[model samples]
Target: MVNLNAVLLISFLLFSIGVIGVLIRRNALVILMCVELMLNAANLNFIAFARHSGSVSGQAFALLLMGFAAAEVAVGLALVVALYRKRDTVQVDDINLLKG
Candidate 1:
């Protein structure tokens, strides 16, 4: 049987990496990837706890979270594409506010 502590530790590590990446990276694509990593970490936590407790609620929540993440990615990528088209760059610092 897998240890719960190990799973939790791995999830924490993934989340930490994602947070650091988001804070340090300036590229819009990289930041989006980091956000996805963070989401996956949360999913891992939910699944691990659900298995440990022998309950499906956590898994159900994880599935719902996945749907939200998918929608977020779709919208985020659209924004990034729009930004690239307008600014000709994907660097976050180079893009100005939505104000025209």
Candidate 2:
């Protein structure tokens, strides 16, 4: 059986890495991917806790969160594609809110 502490540690590490990537990356696509990673990490934590507690609620919530993440990715990618077509670039720094 995997230790609960170990699972939590790994999830925390994944979350931290995702946060760093989102903060450091300038490309919109990279940022979006990092956000997804963070969401996955949270899902992992939910699953781990649910497994340890022998409850279905956390897993159910994780599934719902995944669905939301999927929708968010779809919309985010569409926006990125539209922005790329209009701006010819995906760099976050280059895109100005007022210009778009």
Candidate 3:
């Protein structure tokens, strides 16, 4: 059997990479992809715990989170598209309409 610690370590690594990408990247699309990566990392944890515990709650929660992630992606992409259309650029630093 694969060790739980190993699974958790991998998940942590994935999440950390996502966080670093989100913090350091300037492109909106890249940030969005990082956010998705983070969400998947969370899902991996949920599944790992569910497998370890032999219960379905964690899996159920993971499913719910997946749905939420999907909706978030849809809405986030729509907003990015709108922002690009308005500003002609997807750089996080350049499109600051909420600066006030």
lDDT of 2 by residue, 5-92 (tens): 9999999999999999999999999999999999999999999999999999999999999999999999999999999999999999
Worst-scoring 10-residue span by lDDT in model 1: 91-100
**Candidate 3 lDDT score relative to the true structure:** 0.97
Please give, for residues 1-100, the per-residue lDDT of candidate 3 as tens digits: 8899999999999999999999999999999999999999999999999999999999999999999999999999999999989999999999777996
| Candidate 1 clashing pairs, residues 3+ apart or interchain | none
Tell me the TM-score of model 3. Answer: 0.94
How many clashes show up per model? 0, 0, 0
What C-alpha lDDT do the candidate models reach, one value each? Answer: 0.96, 0.95, 0.97
Regions of candidate 3 where Cα sits further than 4 Å from its true position: none
Candidate 2 off by > 4 Å: 98-100
The estimated TM-scores of all candidates read: 0.92, 0.92, 0.94
- As for TM-score, the candidate ahead, 2 or 3, is 3
TM for candidate 2 is: 0.92
Q: Lowest summed lDDT over 10 consecutive residues: which window, candidate 2?
A: 91-100
Root-mean-square deviation (CA) per prediction: 1.8, 1.7, 1.1
